[model samples]
Target chain A: MLNKVEAYFTKELKEKAGILVVLTLLLLVPQYSWRLFFLLLLIASLLPRDVHRGKIKLMVSLPFSKGDVFWISYAFLITIIVITQIIGGAFFNISLSGIGWDILGTLIFSSAYFGIAMISVSLGFGNFGIPFLVLIADSFFGAIGNNWEFTYNLFRSPSGLNPYRMISPIYQGNRFAAFVFAAALLITAYILFERKGTSK
Target chain B: MIVKVENLQKSFSGKFVLNGVSFDVKEGEMFALIGPNGAGKTTTLRCLYGDLTPNGGKIELFGKAFSSKSKERIAVMNEERETFRRLTGGDYVKMWSLLYPKWNDKIFSNFALHYKFDLEQRVETYSIGMKTVFYVALTVASNADVLILDEPTQHLDPLIRNEILKVISNYTLEEKKTIIISSHEIYELEEISTSFAIIKEGKVLYSDTVDDAKASHRLISRDEKASQGEVIGLVGDDTLVKTDKDVGRFPKFEEIVLGYLGGRREFIPF
Candidate 1:
């Protein structure tokens, strides 16, 4: 399983050069842009397009099941996100509080992104169109106010005072609810992908 | 039996690809699935390997339910070469060795040398024939219990094709491995296959051992176009008849196949 995870990471590195380059460029952005940059890169790293339907079929046909492939890829993407954050933190000279908040925020954001990518790819939404559509949906909902907080603020930086922003980096503002939301999304994605995995 | 598929059905968007297709492959037998294009051969094979779940029916391997454990013992060569084309041949094999528990490095190295496989070149650089050979080699090297090959000779030159067949035959002979090969190459199949199934339009038209099938069905030039003696089918003026009585001798494997396919009679021997 460890070998499989390493193989997936190597494969992603070779296949997702564009995503890596975009994530690298995010480091040069100003401090204020760090929130958006981190979110964008988190979402970008989780784009399911790196593994196509053919590759999925091949992978699933191996000694691993569909869930195995999903979780392995999930672990790989999460690692990439962590490494990127480490590099970004060093370059931007973020304070301890900022780094702590960024890590938590990135985890929640990545969980949501991972869920969306899994559902999109498994449900036959072409990989290229999904991330673009996700960004659009996020902005649309974000513009609608806190009423759609759970949906719109999925990738936003956590706020300590804002109750609507249940999942934040610093102060615990309904952080439990945020974790539950993330868990729900991840579980739903797993169920849908496993169901869609039924042979055609 | 090593493989048992009962009432297997599959469809895509309401269009039936396999309508209750079923067959059993005994241990150590080379079972050939012969059918024309769009005849559900590939779909059936996919179902057997659990690559695709059937809409209905049961598939058992080694008397247990099918799952990843079944997949571990099965090595498949699909019709499409949709592999990671960016990886070099050596890298691809290395990746597979990690995934397949029974991978045999020594045997693979020996076979690669004997076949002159290019391990240094990326898959994209290889010709279609080379790609086919490379993947087939990878599958064979996995040393799985069951091997499912779909159109293994699709894009191969005659020399390479013969060499591959020789290697496969040697593997089966030595290992007693069960092989399920789906191909349009009937004559090639006749050379190695112990039994075969002829399917059309998502249904099994005939399933029997090569000798039994030949012994039961005979080609006769009869007048008045009579569909007699359990008429299998017809081709031009000849009629293919399956009878208990000796009709001199049965036709060749290809002749019997053409007779059954071309003949207009529907004989369901389930």
Candidate 2:
């Protein structure tokens, strides 16, 4: 696993360097909303880049399996997100203990989005198209749900409210339900990636 | 057998691309899969290496069911030659050395030197032929037991093509490794491949050892329609027939492949 990670890092050195620059710039922003937006953009684009470019087939041709690829990529994404969030919090002089929930929330949100992006890519949808559309719709609805009580209740009732609220700005929804939704999405994405024909 | 594929079926959208393609590749033999475009050659290779899961069929590698572990012993060079285009040749060596447990840097370096590759330059800067050679070199250096190469010698001059073919032939001979190569260079492959399977429209029309395939089939004059042996196809003024009787002259490997793939050629009256 370590070898695979080292190989992946070496292969993607240039892209990772560019990501570091973007991340540094992201740290300069004071608003969490903007930071989250850019972070999600990074996740949406970077996580599925290999699949979109048809490089996943090449990767799998090596000793690595599809499961290894998926988990390694997902773990790498989570690691980067956690590390950056910690740095951002420290740089802004926020207490680490107080920001634990903030970090968890960000991680959950990112995992859900990553799952959606991966599923889209595995299903032959371009990396940016479906995920970007989903982000737009989520933000639009999340905003309305936050501002309107009736709208929030309508979404929160029974029609898959937990998954939607996971990405919403309002933190009043059930966290457990959100976690289950994210887990389900990631599992489904992994299965699709395993079964899908990776030849390009 | 090193690789066994039975009743392989694959469909794209709603139509079938590979309908029950089957073949067996023995250990330490150079097996060739030759066919025209859209004959499911690349698709079969992909499925063999686990790049594509067949909708129905069985693939056994190393005398066991094909799995992720099987890939550890298999080195595949896909048709696209896909890689990190921004990375240099040196970067590939470094990355592959880490990925492949049996990687031999000396082999890769020797090939790089022989091919006159500039290791510092990005892979995208290399010509198509160079990229193909580079990928082949990497696959060879991987030192795996099984090498599945799809169009290994595509887009090269005659001299370089022959050199690549020799390198492939030598790899199997010196290392005693198994190779499943797909190619349109039937004449060139005929010299090196020990056995071959001619595929057409997602079916294996004929598969046998090079010696047997040539010995069993004969090309006779088209005018002399054979009363013995099954007629395979027409080749210009000749008819390719499979028979045990002493009739027409023995067919070359390319003739047999062309007969199976092209069949009877239709000419337009001008």
Give the whole-model CA lDDT for all candidates, comma-separated. Answer: 0.73, 0.82
Question: Per-residue CA lDDT of candidate 1, range B1-270, in tens?
Answer: 899888889888888989888789988888899998999999998877766767898999988878766777888887886666467777778778887888998878877887688888777788888778887888888998888988988899999899888777766788899889999888788888888888889988888899998888777776633344787777555677887666634778877777766667545589
Give the range where candidate 2 chain B is weakest over 10 consecutive residues by summed lDDT: B259-268
Regions of candidate 2 where Cα sits further than 4 Å from its true position: A27-30, A136-172
lDDT tens per residue, model 2, A13-125? 56567775776578446586687677667776565877887777777778788888888888877777777777778888889785677677777677777888899988888
| Tens digit per residue, CA lDDT, model 2, B90-208 | 88888778877899989998998899999999887898899999989988999989898999988888899898889899888989998999998887888899998999899989899
For residue A198, give model 2's deviation from the true position in Å: 3.5
| Model 2 / residue B103 / CA error / Å | 0.7
Highest TM-score against the true fold, candidate? 2
Model 1 misplacement above 4 A: A21-47, A50-54, A95-100, A128-131, A139-173, A198-200, B224-228, B265-270
Compute each candidate's TM-score over C-alphas.
0.86, 0.92
